[model samples]
Target: MLKPILKLLALCAFCWAFFASADVLTVRQDAPERYVVKKGDTLWDISALYLSEPWRWPQLWRMNPQIDNPHLIFPGDVLKLVYGPDGRPMLVRDNRVVRLSPRTRVTDTRPDAVTTLPLAMIRPFLTHDKLMTAEQLNGQPYILGASSNVKNATEGHILYARGELEPGKGYAIYRRGKAYIDPETKDELGHELNLVATSRAFRAGNAANNEPASLQVMDARREIRQGDVVLPSIDGEALPAYFHMSRPELAVEGLIIDTTSNLREFSKWDIVIINRGTNEQLQPGNMLNIVRPSPTVVDGNDGKPVYLEDSSRYQRLARNFGHEQITMPREMVGHLMVFKVADRASYAIVTDTFRPVRVGDHIISP
Candidate 1:
């Protein structure tokens, strides 16, 4: 008789324990009680540093709709983090909201000077073009140098070669290369800039084989110097109008507000992050696409996968697998692209296994 009763008691105890350990949404405890907005600070950066994650900022801000625009949380605004019964974090604005009033000080007191001149127009110059074969030109190893003290060139910086390989008095130099990230994370955030440019070769090689050449800045800023890797310019027609302009603004749609788990592997065709929000233009139920990095293969014979080289055992396996001749110990895997976005950290799915989506997958722009 007691045996059945004891078993029933044990079952009830197990059920109680499960519910006790389960996480239920409640007010947070350690809410940031204070914050001072500074110049040039974006709400994204502040949310990441103060909250568990930046994407959660909307939830925190939703607690108080009177705060107005989320972007309006600008410099001089004071923020306060609050907590409720569940021990979750919440945000509040303090008396500092009134600091946005206009200032009376004016520093620029000088009178404005007006000058009007008809727009000066210069006639376009007409020149003859000539083509030279590879044998007609003398080629020298190019050395790149920089004037901005940056070891690696970035966007808008100028780069030039210091060797003698001249056509006329002044010819243009340009760079064309693909941009990628080191230790590739297969995430959208990991993508780095791949810059290309074209400029004129200035001072001719006057003295020795190692002499420097005079270079002039044409389009981009002239900062990079000899020893920087650059390719010869390619002659082409003008690019499309959209190529020179910024991308169009995307409409805010939906968001991946919550995730069931934190451990996720991102692959191709996974949703990453979304920019829309309640404050922006996003709402619930809108759909967004997830993107992942394209698959890359490495060979086994090579040492390893480096930025410029992919010589790994995996690469060899991939090659063998392509032929379908025999089975080798080669593995095919993918990468993830994470967008830390300064304050907001999110990831996109980079690999696809026809399995369940995980935490670190992408939620891309909609």
Candidate 2:
């Protein structure tokens, strides 16, 4: 179920103050006067149909307080665009209803309401990825062996692990992935626990007797091999039913440390890992702008290749000719919203991309 509608409204009100500029609402030129909410339509997708920036959805909802439970949107509901008293555009629900005697009308609505983004795209990251500190990585239980003394195991195989574990509980099998390092500070942020498979603890281990616990492989994304670490399955409760898109409360400057599936270049709808999280006060729903440094080139040169500030070749040529360097302004390539926050890193999904974003790109408050 989604959070209480009142809380969502309050969050929208709080974020309204942070808008960079106060311009009249910019509705799309092709915006429809009335739209019927359809199945599989997300709040963002619907908003994009009317507003230039879909993240301003909460703002659009806030304009019409007369509509009850506006955030609990359902399919078949009719949304009509009307002007408020101040001549500002607002979206109002126009569900046809009969005015019978004073009584609460009951109707069956799906428990899963329309949310901000497509849940299917982020479900795997929510279920499979877990960031771990060095200590936690070292302390996790690892696969000892498989049934019939096999070195590798797959689904339906019985595997043995050595560690303290609760019987009959589900756990995720993982292997240590790349360690994240801050591009600017060069500090080790954390390591990624790449999920391999899932298993249920059939028997708990006895540390005093040096006995290993047995597990039944319930599912496999790949072969569940010996030496793979086992960690508690990430809870589905982490998936919020609904959240408002907002900017981080604090000023945070960080880099895109990595991408999901080791992608060389990522665009809209892709998941990325950044080096700022709880440490930088990042929270779910916070939006960040992906920025790329503009190229710097030799001044007064025709078709010369772009050069870095510290390029030795540029330094040698500049010393001889005394030509100045021209640095272009940084440009924003994309926008992303944080959906999960860890200790020193966070998982964000790309919402918009003007150009392909890459690792090492900088992220700033939108």
Candidate 3:
């Protein structure tokens, strides 16, 4: 009986040791690292590049006070990864600052370096739709005369008009309409303005010719503009420019595959969406950081040694078994960002980890 009891105790000790070692491994694997700063970048964008999650950037950033304004990282800043004597990756950046010379560029005066588009040719591409009403048109501070001096106007008819203080010679016309709303919530979002027609002044009239001229409504409606705002229209779809703002771009190497909002919603094969798109100037072959939540304090009493309730009756035995049992806080797991954006809703694959990632997990730009 004594031998059997000793064997059982040994087995329990072995199990505890194994689990403790595993926990340490998990912590080390999740530790942060130092990252070098490059040009055309900001701290917000940098943080998203290295860490599992971008929001937790404050943690790694707090480690470096030399960063001063958080926006001061310039090109050629050397970031070192410091570790403890135990070889464990400790806090990132010790706030050491190293500056380097800037890169110079060569200018080319060749014709290949310059391209121009004629205004006449570009005008067609620059037009956009606007929505308006007839009443709103009459209320406009600018009006010279109606087509054929008519009191009423209909769609597709060019109105001889003058603008406020200036003769309306080359101004485009549009009609304002109802606001757009969300299909489900019916919440008003934005106005759906439509373009009525383009107007060209045949005769330049004096500003004093404010006879409350009627403007032509290109698209006919039951009633003309009642209360609508008029704004200049652009010609065609606009392309997104390079995002130089402190936004994260693919900086390092990694793949994204999963995402989660909470432990209950965690999945290994979950999908994630990136803000980058073709319109945003993103292309194939870019990498981004997959972020996970930073470790947080869950319960203070956790990890404390505890004795079994049944053993409490035996004061001496309970005292020998220790005061309480300790359990570590639960850690939330997630994926890293990988893969270039294909469209507005590009998909990424979660590559690593045993846990699920949450929504709002960010992919930092490299």
Please report the candidate that would top lDDT against the real structure: 2
> Across residues 193-237, which tens digit of lDDT does each residue of candidate 2 receive?
778998999899987899999899998998777889998875565
Instruction: Tell me the TM-score of each prediction against the true structure.
Output: 0.28, 0.79, 0.27
Worst 10 residues of 2 by lDDT: 98-107
Better of 2 and 3 by lDDT: 2
User: Candidate 1 residues 1-366, lDDT tens each?
Assistant: 999999999999998988964433333345456877766454444664564333345555655543643444545667777665656555767754433335542232222211010001100000111112223223533446654666655445433465664533434432222222212243222111122334555456654776665455455433343443333444452221111111114543222322212334433434333322333333322223433333343434444433213344544556656422222232223222222121122222232233444442234442
Compared with the true structure, the alpha-carbon lDDT of candidate 3 equals 0.40
lDDT of every predicted structure (CA atoms): 0.38, 0.81, 0.40
Clashing pairs in 2: none
Query: Which regions of candidate 2 deviate over 4 angstroms?
Result: 1-31, 36-40, 63-71, 74-77, 86-88, 95-108, 111-113, 234-238, 300-322
The best-first sequence of candidates by TM-score reads: 2, 1, 3
Number of backbone collisions per candidate, in order? Answer: 62, 0, 51
Per-residue lDDT for 100 in model 3? 30
Distance from true location, Cα of 181 in model 3, Å: 2.5
Model 3, which residues run further than 4 Å from truth? 1-32, 39-45, 49-53, 56-65, 80-179, 192-366
